[model samples]
Target chain A: MMSWLGETWAILSKEWRCELRSRYALSTVLLFAITTLIAVSISVGPAGATPEQRPLMPVLLWLILLFAATAGLPRTFVHEEETHTADPLRLAARPSCLFCGKTLYNLTLLLVLEAVVTPLFLVLLQVEVADLWSFAIALLVGGVGLAVGSTLIAAMVAQARARGPLFAVLAFPILLPLLKLVIDASFVAVAGEAQSPALGLAVLYDSMVTVASLMLFPVVWNP
Target chain B: MTIKQKTFRWLLFVWLAATIWAAFFYAPLSQGFAGKMGDAPQSSRIVFFHVPLAVASFFAFLVAAAWSGVYLWKRRSIDDHRAVAAIEVGMLYCVLATVTGAVWSKVQWGAYWNWDPRQSSIVLALLYYGAYLSLRGAVEDSEVRARLSAVYAVLGFVVAPFLFFILPRMASFSLHPTPGSAEMDREIGLVVVAAIAGFTALFCWIASLRRRVLDLNAEAG
Candidate 1:
C-alpha cells in the first residue's frame, strides 16, 4: 500500500511537472475557468444576485468542472501518446498501478482548478460561506467525486470516436447523482443550512464513487 | 433443440402461468398502506405490476453485467452476443419500470412527476442504458462495438450503485418511500417478495428468448 501510494505520488508530481513545464492543460483550464466564472457572474449580475439565486452557483461550478475536466482528460493520455511512452510504461508497470497514478494526477489537476475557482466564485457571487472550513471540505469531497469519475471515463472514451463531446454524453448521466450531492452540499454550505448533514451526504457520495472506481478501474485498465 | 432451450421453454410456461395466477388472484387489494396510510384516493393494487417491473429491471441489469464480465474475460463472440442480449432486455424492463413508476407517482403524489430521487434515478438509468444501446447501434465494426459496449456496460454497473442507492439516502425532498424502514408492513413486504419472484421468472424467460435470437444471428453470420 505504501509503495502504491509512493507510485501514485510519483505519477502525480510527474504530471504536475509536465503541466507546469508545458502549461498546456493548466493554462487552458485556468483560462477557461476564469472566463466562465466572469461570464456567470455577469449573467447573475453583481448587485442583483442574492441567496435565493445561490443554487445557480453549484450548477455553474459543476458545469465549469465538467467542461474543464473533459478538456483536460484528452491531455492526460494525449501527452503519453505523443511521447510514445505509454507502451513501455504499461509493459513495465502494473495497469492498476498505472490507473492509481493517473487518478492521482487527475485529482491534482481538478483540485488545482477548484482551488483557483472557489475563491473567485465567493468573491464574484457574494457567497456567504457558512463556515469556511465546511465550504472547503465540501469542495474537497465534491472535487474528488468529479476527478475519479472523469479519470475512468476519460480512459474509456479516449480511443473512441468523437472523444470530445462523447465524454460529456457518457459522463453526464452517470454523474447526475454526484452532481446533485455536490450542489446540495454547496447550497447548504453557502446558505448556512443543514451544514453537517449536507457535508455528510456529500461524503457519502464521494465514498460511493471512490470505492466503485477503485474496484472497477483494474477491470477496464487491464487487458 | 439444445438442452438449455428446451428446459428454459418448459420453465417459462410454468412461470407464466404462476405470475398470471398470483398477480390476478393472490395479491391483496389494499386501499392505501392499510387504512390510514392508503392515501392515494384509490386502490393500491398496481403494486403487483409496479413492483414486478422494478424488480425485473434489477434482474435484467444483473444479467447484463454478468454477461459483460464474461465477454471481457473470454473475448468470445458468443459472450458478446449474450452481453448485448441481456442489455436489450434490461432496457426493456427498465422502460416498463419507469412507465409503471410514473403511473404510480401520478396517482400517489398527485402528479406524474415529483422529482423524487428514485423517480429521477430510474429515468437516468433508462436514459443511460438507452445511450448504451445507441452506442451499440452507432458502431458498425462488430469487434470494436462489442469491446467498447462491454466496457461501457461495466462502467454503468459500477456507477449505478451510487446513482440509485447512495444519492437517494442523502437527499431530503424525495417523496418516494424509502425501503426497509419500520413503515413497511408485513403484507406489503410479502406482496413485494412475490412480485419480485414473479418478475424475476419473467425476466429469465425473456432473456432466454433474446439469447436464442442472438444465437440465431450468430449462426446466420
Candidate 2:
C-alpha cells in the first residue's frame, strides 16, 4: 500500500514537473477561462438590473468553467501520448496509480481554476452568494466531479483522432447531471436557501462518477 | 434467415399490427385537464407508439452496455459487434421516439420544443450514443476502437440513469407527468404493455440482423 501510494505520488509529481516546464495546459486553461469571463462580462455588463439576467449567472459561470475545462483537461493524457511517454509510464506504474495521479493533477488544476474564476465571476457578474458556505461546498464537490469525469474521458479519447472535439462531445452528456446539480445548488446559494437539495445531489453525482471512473479506468488505460 | 427466425419475425409483425389497432381503435382516449381541451383526441394515441419506442431504446442501450462490459472481460469480437449493433438499433428507436414525442407535443402543447425535461433528457441520450458511434468511426485500429468504445459504452451507461431518471425527477419544473402520478386506464395500459412487448421483439430482431450483417462484413474484409 505504501509503495502504491508512493508510486502515485511519483506520477503526480512527474506531471507537475512537466507542466511547470511547459506551462502549456495551465496557460491555455487560464486563457480560455479569462477570455470567456471577459466576453460574459462585456455582454451582460456588470449584472444588468434585469431580474431575468440574474438567474443566468450560475449557468454562465458553469458554462465558462466547462468550456475552460474542455480546453485544458485532455492534455493530461493527450500530452503523454503526444510525447510518446505513455508507454514508458504504463510500464512503470499500475493503471490505478496512474489514474489516481492523473485525476489528482486534473483536480488540482480545476481547484486553482475555480479559485481564480469564481471570485472574478462574482465581482464582474455582480452575483451574490447568499450562502457562502453552501456555494463553496457546491463548487468543491462539483469540481471533483468535473475532474473525475473529464480525466477518465480524456484517457479514453487521447489516442483517437480529433481529440479536442471528441472530448467535449463525449464529456458534455456525462457531465450534464453534475452540471444541473451544481447550477441548482448555486441558485440556492444565491437565494440564501437554508436547505439545498442540489448540494446533496452534487455529492451523489460526485460519488457515482468517481466510482464509475475507478472501475472503468483500468480498461481504458490499458488500451 | 432460419425457419424459426422467419416465423418469429412474422409473429412480431402481427403483434405490432395488433398493437397499433388496439391503440387507435380499442384504447380509450385520455381526458384532458379540466377547462382545457376536453380530450387528447387522436394525438394521445401516439403515446402507445412513442412510449414503447422510448422504452425499447432504453433497453437496447442497456443491452449494448452489458455486451460492452462482457467484451471487456472476455475480449470477444462478437460481443463488441453485438454491442455496436444494439446501439445502432437503439439510436434509431431513440430518434423515432423523439420525433413522435415532438409531434405529440406540438399538437398538445402548441410548441414543437419546450425544453421539457423528458424531451431534453432524450436529446441528451441521443447525443451520448451519437458520440459513441462517432468515436467508433474516428478510431483507426479495430482493437483500439473496440476497447475504447467498450469502456465508453460502459461508462455512458453508468451515467445514463442519472441523466434520464434522477435529474429529471429532481428538477423543479417539468411538463411531463410523473410515472404513476396519473393512474392510466386499464385498457390503455394493456395496449401500452403490448406495444412495449412488440417494440422489444422488433428491437431484438433488428439487432440480430445487424449483428449478422456485421459478421458478414467482417468475414468479407
Candidate 3:
C-alpha cells in the first residue's frame, strides 16, 4: 500500500513536470474559464442576477468550471497517447497507480481552475456567498469527483479516434449528478444555509465514483 | 423458426394485443385531476404504456450493464454484443418513454418541455447510451471497443442511480407520480404490470435478434 501510494506520487510529480514544461493543458483550461467568465460577466454586466434569480451565480460558476474542464482535462490522457509515451508508461506503471496519479494531477488542475475563475466570478459577476464554508467544501469535493471521473473517461477516450468533443459527450451524463449536487451546495451557500445535504451527497458521490473508477481503470488503461 | 420459437413469437404478439385491449377497454378510467379533459379517461391510459416503456428501458440498460460487466470478466465478444443489443433496444424504449411522458406532461402539466427532473434524467440516459454508441463507432478494433465500452457501461451502471433516483427525487416538485402502485386501482395496476411484462419481453426479443445479427456479422467477417 505504501509503495502504491509512493508510485502514485511519482506519477503525479512526473505529470507536474511534464505539464509545466508544456503548459499545454493548464493554459488552455484557464483561458477557456477566463474567456467564458469575461463574456458572461460582460453580458450580466455590473448588475449581478436579478432579484428573482436565486441560484444564478452558483449555476453560472459551476457551468463555467464544467465547460473549462471539458475544454482541457482530457488532455491529461490524450497527451500521453499523442506523444507515443503511452506504451512505455503502460509497461512501467501499474494501472491503479497511473490512474491515481493522473486523477490527483487532474484534481490539482481543476483546483487551479476553480481558484482562478471563482474569485473572478465573485468580483466580476459579483457572486456573494452567504456561507463560505459550504461553498469551499462543495467546490473541493465536486472538483475531486469531476477529476476522478474525467481521468477514467480521459483514458477511455484517449484510445478513440475523435478525442476532443467525444470526451465531453461521454463525460457529461456521468458528471451531471455530481455537478447538480455541487451546484445545489453552492446555491445553499449563497441562499444562507438551509442545512442542505448536497455537500454530504457530493462526498458520497465522489467516493462511489472514485471506487468505481479505480475498479474499472485497469480495463480502460490496458488494451 | 422452430415450432416453439414461432409459437412464442405469436404469443408475444397476441399478449401485446391483449394488453392494448385491456389498457383501453378493460381498465377503469383513471380519476383525472383538474384540467381540460383531465377528466378524460384517456389521460389515465397513458400510464399503462408510459410506465411500462420507462420500466423496460431501465431494465434494458441494466441488462446492457450486466452484459458489459460480464464481457470485461470473460472477454467474450458475444457478451459485448449482448450489451450493445440491450442498449439499442433500451434506447428505443427510453425514447418512447420520453416522448409519451412529454405528451402526457403537456396534457397534465400544460408544457411539452419543462426540463423537469424526470425529463432531464431520461434525456441524459439517451445521451449516455448515445455516447456509448459513439464511443463504439470511434474505435477501430472490436476487441478494444468491447473493452472500453464495457468499462464505460459499468461506469454508467454507477451513474444510472444518480440519474434515475437522486436527480428527480431532489426536485420534489416533479409532477410525476411516486410508485403510484399503492394508490392505483386494481385493474389499472394489473394492466400496468401486464404492459411492463410485455414491453420487457419485447425488449428481450429485439435484443436477442440484434445479438444474433452481430453474431452473423462476426461470422461473415
Model 3, position B48, has a per-residue lDDT of 88
> By TM-score, how accurate is candidate 2?
0.97
Report how far off residue B134 is in candidate 3 (Å).
0.6
iRMSD values, candidates in order = 2.8, 1.0, 0.6
TM-score of 1: 0.83
Scored against the true structure, residue B32 in model 2 reaches a CA lDDT of 39
- Chain A alone, model 1, TM-score? 0.89
Give the clashing pairs for model 3: none
Whole-model lDDT values for every prediction: 0.73, 0.89, 0.90
DockQ of candidate 3 relative to the true structure: 0.89
Candidate 2, DockQ score (0 to 1): 0.80
Task: List clash counts for every candidate, in order.
Answer: 1, 0, 0
Q: Check candidate 2 and list the clashing pairs.
A: none
**Measured against the native two-chain assembly using Cα atoms, what DockQ does each of the candidate structures obtain, in the order listed?**
0.34, 0.80, 0.89
- lDDT tens digits by residue: candidate 3, A125-213: 66678888888888999999999999999999999999998999999999999999999988988878789778888898999999999
Please give the distance, in angstroms, between residue A146's alpha carbon in candidate 3 and its true position after superposition: 0.7
Angstrom error of the Cα, residue A49, model 3: value is: 3.3
Candidate 3 contains a number of clashing pairs equal to 0
TM-score of chain B as predicted in candidate 2: 0.96
How displaced is residue B165 in candidate 1, in Å? 2.6
Could you give the candidate ranking by lDDT, starting with the highest?
A: 3, 2, 1
